[model samples]
Target: MGRKEFYWYYKLHATTAIFPTRSDGKLSKYKHLGKAGSQTYIDAIEQITARTRIEALDRSIEALRQGLKDLVEETSKYNKE
Candidate 1:
């Protein structure tokens, strides 16, 4: 299908491409890249996506660990025979 939308203009654009600001306050573009550049552009996008996912998971795991630790500490305070 034709380009229904555009994002990451800064990451993937031709050397001669120009994105101008439109009068309607929407972003305007002059050119889009074909499948002509080196594979590094796509590789970078994948790496960035993976890194973001890993970071989010790490934060979630740490939060769960802290919650469990707090629960154990509170339970240990109960009197025992």
Candidate 2:
């Protein structure tokens, strides 16, 4: 059997992403996923906070549908006037 290893991605500052090397200043072999403001990073965090990606996506889709429905109703009411 083999074990999977994980590394920590700490944002030293708000601008860039860097692998914090040790006192020897050596970067680890871990791959960088994505930057903070990028869509990948946002989705990853959302999935972590929510039960699952499907649930998070469902919530967003439902909100959009409701907003569209409201806009249609408002437009129809205005047209009726």
Give the least accurate 10-residue stretch of model 1, judged by summed lDDT. Answer: 29-38
Overall local distance difference test of candidate 1? 0.63
Q: Residue 34 of candidate 1: its Cα lDDT?
A: 33
Candidate 2 off by > 4 Å: 1-51
Considering only N, C-alpha and C atoms within 3 Å, which residue pairs clash in candidate 1? Answer: none
Q: Give, for candidate 2, the lowest lDDT window spanning 10 residues.
A: 10-19
Off by over 4 Å in 1: 1-38, 79-81
lDDT of 1 by residue, 1-81 (tens): 798876543244435534544455545444233343436556656766999999999999999999999988888876442
Best by TM-score: 1
Q: Determine the backbone clash count of candidate 2.
A: 0
